[model samples]
Target chain A: MGQVVVVTSGKGGVGKTTTTANVGLALGMFGQRVCLIDTDIGLRNLDLALGLDERVVYDLIDVCSGVCRLQQALLRDKHIETVYLLPAAQTKAKTDITPEQMRTLLEQLKPSFDFILLDSPAGIEQGFQNAIAGADWAIVVTNPEPAAVRDADRVIGLLHGAGLTDVRLILNRLRTQRLDARSTGNGTAGLGEIEEVVDQLAVDLLGVVPEDERVVDSNLQKEPLVLHQQDRAGQAYREIARRMLGESIPLMELTPPKPFWRRLGLRFGHHARVERK
Target chain B: MGHRDPSLTRKWGQGGKRRAMAYLPSHIRVKGSRDGLTFYFDGNVAMEVWLAELQQLLQREHHLFQGPAVPVRICFGRVPLGTEEAAIRACFASHPNLIVHRVEASSTSITSRTGEKERTAPTLLWGPVRSGAEIQSDGALIVAGDVHSGARLVAKGTILVFGILRGMACAGSDGDIEAIIAAWELACPVVEIASRRKSFEKLSAGPTLVRLEGEELVTAPARHLKRGQGGREQPWAKWWS
Candidate 1:
């Protein structure tokens, strides 16, 4: 049976859907049959991220309402044969799917895939509860902000309360948020801030996604970040996916690489100092 | 209810009754009940003068007031005792006798203001006491894990945490001035004890204890609290039983 993972964060705009799309694609690259379920309901965006919005014929609601079978509702991405996108209904509200219904649907789809990633909606509402109903593990995606970390703690607490023991954290937008001196507390966080949050939440760190404009560009271009090879954020997502599969991998170094001239100069200086020694 | 400085209450055995009954204030009426003395204050008198006369009464008739350990319960007749209640507690503090037990208003209950009628046994918990979670106890409360921010813990008696405390902890919620809150790590912004509260701007670096000392909240290192044979939880063992 496949392991179902829910990507969730309690607060809004912490990149739950984006992380879901990218991680799902990365899992697909590893030869796993990946299924993506967008449980955001009215705020559906997973199909657009996969560039398969036009190919969505039926959705989660239609399948739940018995209008179509689960396979008919599932949309396979054009470029990748291993991944499928189960779009959420744009017209329905978050209250549409009950937790029992979501759990039953996931149970039916478990035998067909190696990994199923449920893209949970933001907030600690019914949508989030329904999305995590059948999830064996949870991935909490958060920005390196106090508010986001606080929300992630709340979500972890809820998951623990529900007896879901395996929960991991993803620190996204690390060192990438623009610092604003005018604002009260909305600014770029440092390594110390990330350490404080990780300490406070007390969860296993999955991976860190640095602030990269390419990630935003990927969303705008209607393609998932994992589709773009050799990208920093894509590599982070890949690492997270591998970790989820129980592969041991060290985290990427967060510091940006130096420019070519600066690297060359430092190398030459180090070599001359070694020759003198 | 408490001994002011542990200085007296030994004088209760002497002949303390014959020399009293000189004068009793008009607004204040003292009655003997099955439990100890109950003082009823008329609401018409101003709060200051009422407290002053009560103080003078206890001062002049100090010999008559020294008796059993049952706390003296006061009833405020038909008036809202707001901040005036704290002033009343302050008055009781200097008596070297008499502790403020319960505040009885013509409006509120005589039993439970913040807790049940009687304080129960201490509650022991294994916890993160997660965000948005609330834990309340009639008696003392002990947690083996962290108390996260946005969480709340209120107890009628003392509260003890073996891990970090980053939430709101209110000890002495039922107005017991002797209650305390101690944690392995303290980051609580505000702490309330016996209806009095104090806020902190920074986190405490080590194990700390927050308690009430002479009508004010004071914090000190919890390591100073003696521990016995019970191991790491020894200090709180007495509170549990």
Candidate 2:
């Protein structure tokens, strides 16, 4: 049976759909048969993110409501042959699929795929409940900000309450320059350290995706970042995928480079201090 | 209805009373009393729905209740069990000045036959109060975890947070000038003690105490409060004296 993983974040616009698409694509690149399911219902974006919006003939609601078979609704990716997309219905309400129906649908698809990824909607509402209904593991995406961290904590609490104990943290949109400036006292409020976030959420760190402009370009081009290969965010996603596959890959160091003057000043200052000592 | 408002009669008309009643949300009933505005929850609707409506009502009328002295009462139709009271209190988390004067179950069994004033114990919150969550106590209030931004705590007496305080906090909510607000790390954007309010530019990293001094709210290191001194003999006694 395939392992079902749900990507969820309580707060909106924290990149739940992007992480699901890229990670699923990376897993498929590893020769695993992966199926990505969009559970956002009315506000569907996974299809657009995967560049398969035009190819979708049916959606999850259609399969759940018996209008079509699950195989008929699954859209094969053009680039990754092992990856498939199960789009969400744009016209239907989020409450269209109950948790029991979602569980049954995931169970039915488990035998055919190696990994099933559910892209959960924002908020702790019916959509969130439906997304996590049949998941064996949960990946909670959050930013370095306080609000997103708090929401992730709440999601962790809820996931634990639902008996899904294997939850990991993904810190997204980390701005290295901003964090460096804050650490050096140039910035006012620091984006908290990763250790603080891990301590607050009490979850294992899966990966950290630095804030990269290429992510927006990928979204605009309707392509998965992992396919870009050279993009830093894409490499981060690939590393995360490898980590998810139980590989012990070291985390990427994302420190921002300082200006020439600052580096020169630090070097000379260090020489002067050594001579004085 | 002996105390029915004549204006409501004129607005609803005699035959349209049922329609007017249906227009209001059945789960919530708001009324004005000598103590303050009282909100009665009938337990008919789900807690989330009731909280949403309550938040909407408060946000719509926030201008009218902008100060720290506005006493508010939350009365449940039945006594809440477990975290139900905490959930109910979370609805008022954004309104820092809205003082919760009393929270009680309106059931007759809990009320005393002698008609004396009802006393409520201080609410003890167990977990980290997240953003957009609020806790209000008619008496003293204590929280065991951090209070995030957009969350608030209002207490008629002392407000003590065992963890970091990063949100808005209002103590002496009922106009008690001697009330104190203490936290492990004081980093709140706004802190109010009775009518005195001060915004902190830089938050202290260590434990801190905020209390009123001659009508001005002052912050001092909590360790200097003089150990073994109790009651009015403490260093903060100058405010009450």
- Predicted candidate 2 versus true structure: per-residue lDDT over B14-37, tens digit per residue: 567553543354456665544467
Ten consecutive residues with minimal summed lDDT in candidate 2 chain A? Answer: A182-191
TM for candidate 1 is 0.70
Residue A103 of model 2 has an lDDT of: 94
DockQ of 2: 0.14
Error of 1 at B75 (Å): 32
Superposed Cα deviation of residue B114, candidate 2 (Å): 25
Predictions in order: lDDT: 0.79, 0.80
Candidate 1: tens digits of C-alpha lDDT, residues A1-277: 9999999999888888889989999999988999999999998999998999988889999999899999899999776789999999999998877999998999999999999999999889899889889999999999878788878888999999887988999998876433222222222233565567778888898988877789889888888878778788999999988998889998775556657896686666853565566
**Candidate 1: segments with Cα more than 4 A from true spot:** A176-191, A264-277, B1-121, B226-241
State residue B23's C-alpha deviation in candidate 2, in Å: 66
